[model samples]
Target: MRERRRLPRPAKLSVEGESDEFVRPMRRSWTCLARRLRAPPLTALRFLTPPSRRRQRCTPGAAMADVSERTLQLSVLVAFASGVLLGWQANRLRRRYLDWRKKRLQDKLAATQKKLDLA
Candidate 1:
């Protein structure tokens, strides 16, 4: 049978007014500190926590189903407009690139032709 090794426990701090009671030392590891620091503030956490049963019953159908037809149409319109704007921007960039390339090639051809004429 193998003997089990017991890990050392963290040191505890005693409170000034407490007798026979000790508080565990705060973890100082980077991960522990990061978790503590990254935790949402208490006010924000209040909204994130599960709501009471009464509040759940008060709300209507699923959130997605609650959207009005006009809102849906507007959202679709916005999405289509954004897609068109993005495509226009992309084509503009492509045209600029092609123009720059054509100018570069023309300049190179002219330079070669000048050299040939000089020779």
Candidate 2:
């Protein structure tokens, strides 16, 4: 796969209101061992906080939303699937009813012809 490169930003203005400074790894020895790649512009502010605390202020669950964004997506998916199932079932029953009605009418027509011939 080809890797995408970002446009070089002007030195004066910071990208995404945050500068991509050289981030020091947790340990000095580890940094020397691994070849460091250039970091991307900090578009997401969450990275500024410690990894231990994502939603809260330097601590987990200090301030979190009651429902996550995923809940809305899941509800929408379930409703759409239910609608599709109901529609498919309705079409199947409608076809069966129409076929039965056509057969009944054909039988009635055949019975009438038999009586006419006897007369």
Candidate 3:
């Protein structure tokens, strides 16, 4: 059996004010390497970190302050009208399908009756 050849380990490149623990063990792509090299250590680290979720919630009236009463009413009316139209179309299709099925069954019954009369 042949012995496996060992590959040389890549030399560690240290950044000022950054720890070795932060360095990824796996191989990084050229784009990621380029981005890290381009930006300052602090700026790069800042961008990499997730955003803080300590944002203040707006008051109930504060959100509606920008929106006018007429605009709000119009939006509500449009939503209601669209919902009604969709329901009407769905009902119409269902009724048409039921009618078609009933007609088909009646035709089949009539054909069966004709055969029975002939016999």
Candidate 4:
């Protein structure tokens, strides 16, 4: 009777009960863990959080356009001041360059006049 019961158990087994037995379950676990770990932070976060508590994703298109009037005025004032300072510096540099060029030309002319006088 025991032998007869054991004989029918082979047909009930899901597989042939061979070398493939341990492999399938382990492979399935590895694949599942790999997929879970490979998920992006935002995607994995969704699984860890409840729907009601899930944070809204920050979209690049959203902007904070509310600027204070005083900030605008200050920025404009700063820009104008910087422009004035820059213009003053540029004018000073141009004056110095012109003086240097004129001195160089006068020195060259003096040298030529001396050479002509000696000849």
Give lDDT per model, in order.
0.75, 0.68, 0.78, 0.73
lDDT of 4 at 24: 70
User: Candidate 1 — which pairs collide?
Assistant: none
Residue 81 of model 2, lDDT score: 100
TM-score for each prediction? Answer: 0.47, 0.43, 0.47, 0.46
Residue 46 lDDT, candidate 4, scale 0-100? 62
Query: Candidate 2 lDDT, tens digit per residue, 1-119?
Result: 99756444335433465544532322343444344454645765456665564454443454335547798688889999999999999999999999999999999999999999999
lDDT of 4 by residue, 15-114 (tens): 4656767557766765676686684878665666556976667654443235567887999999999999999999999999999999999999999999
Count: clashes, candidate 4 = 0
Candidate 4: where is the Cα deviation over 4 Å? 1-65
Give the CA lDDT, 0 to 100, for residue 33 in model 4: 64
Give the number of the best model, judged by lDDT.
3
* Candidate 4 weakest ten by summed lDDT: 4-13
- Let me know the TM-score candidate 4 reaches against the reference structure: 0.46
Clashes of each: 0, 0, 0, 0
lDDT of 4 at 101: 100
Q: Which stretches of candidate 1 lie over 4 Å from their true place?
A: 1-61
